[model samples]
Target chain A: MKLHSLMLAAGLAATASMGMAEKIKVGMITTLSGGGAGLGIDVRDGFLLAVKGNDDIELVIEDDQRKPEIAVQLADKMIQSEKVDVMTGIIWSNLAMAVVPAATAQGKFYVSPNAGPSALAGKGCHPNYFNVAWQNDAYHEAAGKWASENGVGKVVVMAPNYPAGKDAITGFKRFFTGEIADEVYTKLGQQDYAAEIAQIRASGADMVYYFLPGGMGISFMKQYAGSGADVQVMGPAFSFDQGILGAIGDAALGVKNTAHWSKDLDVPGNADFVAAFQAEYGRLPSVYAAQGFDTGLLLASAAAKADVADADAFRAALKEADFQSVRGEFSFGANNHPVQTIYVREVVKEGDVVTNKLLGAAAENHSDAYAADCKM
Target chain B: MSTLLLIEQVLNGLQFGVMLFLMAAGLTLIFGVMGLINLAHGSLYMVGAFAAAATAAATGSFVLALVAALIAAAAAGAIVELTVIRRLYDRDHLDQVLATFALILVFSEGTRWIFGSFPLYLDVPAALAGPVTLPGGIEYPAYRLLIIGMGLAVAAGLFLLISRTRIGIQIRAGEADREMIGALGVDISKLYTLVFALGAALAGLAGALVGAIQSVQVGMGEPVLILAFVVIVIGGIGSIKGAFVGALLVGLTDTLGGVLLPEFFALFTEASSAKLIGASVASMAIYILMAGVLIFKPTGLFGGQT
Candidate 1:
């Protein structure tokens, strides 16, 4: 009996040594405390749901407090001390810009669940970097296309005065091909929209396109509703996502927004994702949640095929993007950003909950314009 | 822009200025009367907003929401004043600042623990949810117009209270010389508590009013607090009249600069770059005004003491 037990122990040790269980350490730095915490919480919950019951993957999560410097410090700590194999979960573009380049340069793999800035999609693209979310311009570009194709004309464009804001306007103009009545750049995180609403009402434009996200969107929608502005409103999904829809209330109803995914999309794995997310988090998932779940699945698929120790093999495996995405027909562009169909969604009241209902596709096989600028 | 549009923009400026005045009033009052720099005044504003939002959610009454805001903020101010703030009266400015800053963190975290991080839904009352036309054919938001009226009314009430009431006399006397008032048989600690609660109630009222139009979430008060500080500095630190005028000046500069500067640059440069340059300058317009004022009069517009 002793000889048999010794032989069994030796066999188990041999199997473990042969890499039967692969462990991948994941470091998630996100805004978990502050105004932007909702987005990060959703992303973290969705990511965890996808990797549930998997003991092989260890995730180290830290709150960034919506500060770029804190995010940089966390990234450095994750890379230097935690020695994480992969890093993810940055929501804002500025924070992503602060953390991603440095992490990727230090030989740490970064899979962005959101915030695909133009710089990273273009000349600053790194081999170890993968953006599971759409490029910064993709949704806005799709919104522009939907506006132009749906008989909308004479639009006033507004965005925060930042790089992503500029990218939003540029992307909209790329496919809009309509009379641009005016372009307004407001201060970032500004709550008051009275002046802007006054301008919109006076611009004589039939439609107003804006890209204010998070709480700013809520403020704008509420103020715009009260102002009795006669113009129609449209924006990207960031402003109308499930997380903030309740706060916007009925003001967001019937407003059109473009996104790469929706809760009602008739796609494989989407219904399951929505149902599972609701079951786990006891709430409807937002677009940010969808991106995070897809990111997890993609990482899982890559990890199943290749060990992360082999950088070249892991990169090739990630490039394949073999997992089923909630967005459906997902593929990575040459720049490692997502290339997928963008859908137009309308904010609707379903039962008692405010959510999005898929309207139709705005753009098919939509790829970013900056992909050509990437060398690798 | 058309004349009507420009007039509407000015109204927007006035509306914004009125809101800033509400915040600056309380801050200036506390600083003037207490001789203590309270960095946590914004936290009191946040507390009021959260209280109002929660009350509105529960009872579905706007008036009840406002009342709850005032009561909750005043109670919080009294408790904080008695428990934490009373101990810091004799400390140096740096120590007071550090302690109040710590109080801000505590309030922020405590509120987050109770309310979560998502912004609460606070809508304009249905009666005031439409546009009101002014005499010049300028359409303005009725809610904003109401805010301006309320602010003016409060300003008038505050002036009257300061000029007529016995407590106002006591407060003025305390501001002048706290030790002298205490020596004259006045309960100085109780007066200090009352003053703090009064300032907090005003801040709470401002928060509830503005939260109806803006996002009611954590950190919402900090930006307004910064603006309030700018108003007091540009005006005079301890002068309510100065706060009122300074808030309006800053508001007009911010709004008009944002709207007109871009238009002004359109004549000399292309539209997009003009917007870039104009916005960059406009964001600095208030700071520039503050600097210009300081360069001319280092003691501020209405400052009396060195």
Candidate 2:
């Protein structure tokens, strides 16, 4: 009996060694606390759901408190102590800029679930870094293109004063050929937009396009409803994100916005992703969550193709972009940023919940403009 | 630049200032009576907001939310005062500062555990949901006008309460000399609890009123807290009259500086650079005004001994 048991154990060990699935260690640094925690929670939950039932991968997640310095420290700890195979899940662009360069410098893989700052897509592009989400300017550029195509006569563009905001404006101007009425930059995280709303009302612009994210978006939408502004409102989908939509309520209804993916998108994997996310989280997935789930799918596909032990092979495999993306036919541009379609979504009431419904494609097979600046 | 626009901007400034007064009144009162630099005063504001949000979500009544905010904040203040704050009263300001700072962490984390990470949503009641034309034909948000009215009414009520009430006299006596008030059978400890609860209720009321307009999140109170400190500094510690004037001054300076500075700089520079510089300078204007006030009248406009 002992000899028979030893033989069975030896046979199982040999089969395990033969299959030899690659083990990948993932360190997720996200904003899990404070005002912006909702976005991070969605990302983390989506990533975990995508990677569920896979024993070959390990994830260590930490909260950065939305601070750049704390993010840097978390990156260092992940690199030296945890010795992670890949680093992902930074929400804020500032935190991404702080951590990505240093982490990618050490030849470790960095997959951005969000925060695809233009600097990285251009001269700052790193071979080890892959942006699974749209570049910071892609949605803004799409909105601008949509605005121009719709024959918007006079329009005002506004954003918070920051690097991402600059990127968003630059993107918007790339497509908008209309007479720009005004270019306004509000203070980052400024709660009250009554003053700015009044300015927009007085400017006599036919339409207003803005790029305020997170809680700023909530405040602006609520205040905008009461601003008595007659101008049409449009923006990037960040403002109408699912995590914040409940707070915004009917204020955002009928407002058009642009994004890379939506639950209503009739893509091959999108329906499944939306259903699976709802099943797992009991809430509709935000764009952030969709990007996070895609990040997992991309990493799983790449890890399946090449051994993480071979850095060049793994990097080459990642560039292949073999995953069935939630956005459909997702591929990386020369800058390692996403080359995908941008959709126009209208905020609508779904039963009691306020959410988005698909309008149509705004930008198809769109590649970021900064790809020409990248060597790889 | 137009007179109508300028008038509208001034109203915006005044509206902003009035909100600050709500926060400053409670903070200044607490500091004056207790001599405690309670950084955790902001926690009370957050407490009120969360309570209001939760109550509004469950009850769907704006009035119920306000009452819940008041009761929750006052009850929390009383509990904190009895259990933790009473011990810090005899300690130095540094100890008080450190202890209260610790309380902020506890309150923030505790609230997070109860509320989760997402900001709770509160809505403006339908009655005040639209814009109303002012006397000058300027289109203004009725909700903001409501805020301004509530703030002014609270200011008047606080004045009446402090001057025409027996509890107000005891509070004044407690501020003057805690030992003397205690010797005179004023039940000084009970007074401290009552005063702390009152300050907390005021902070809660401010939070509930503003939560409709702002993101009702965990750390929303800190920014308002910093400005409230400025309001107290400029108004004179412990003087309700000082808090009101100082709040208006800070609010106006911040708003007008934000608007006019860009136009003023546009004459000398490009519009974009003008905006960049104007905004940077505008944010500094309040602090600059605060410094000037300190240099000229170190005790503040209405402050005496505090």
Candidate 1: where is the Cα deviation over 4 Å?
Answer: A1-21
Estimate the overall C-alpha local distance difference test score of candidate 1. 0.88
- Give the whole-model CA lDDT for all candidates, comma-separated: 0.88, 0.86
Query: How would you encode candidate 2's per-residue C-alpha lDDT over B1-306 as one tens digit per residue?
Result: 677778888888989899889889888888888887879889999999889988999989999999999999999999999999999988998999899988988898788889887777898888888999988798889999998998999999988888899998987877688789889998888889998999999899888888888778878888889999999999998888899999999999988888888788899998877877777787788999999999998999888864
Q: What TM-score applies to chain A of candidate 2?
A: 0.94
Q: Write the per-residue lDDT of candidate 1 for residues B46-164, one digit (tens) a residue.
A: 99999999999899898999999999999999999999999999989899999999898889878888998778888878899898888988878899999999999988998888889
Model 2, position A47, has a per-residue lDDT of 86
Q: Could you list the iRMS of every candidate?
A: 0.9, 1.2
Judged by TM-score, which candidate is best?
Answer: 1
Q: What would the per-residue lDDT of candidate 2 be over residues A275-334, giving only the tens digit for each residue?
A: 998987788999999988988888877867778989999999999999888888788888
Residues A1-376 of candidate 1: C-alpha lDDT, one tens digit per residue: 0001001101222223335446678898888887788999888888888877655567888888889998998888889988999999999999999999999999989999998999999999999999999899999999899998999989999998988888999999999978999999989888898888988888899999999988888999999999888799999999999988888888889999999999999989899999999998899999999988998888878877788898898899999999999999988888888889999999999998989999999999999998899997
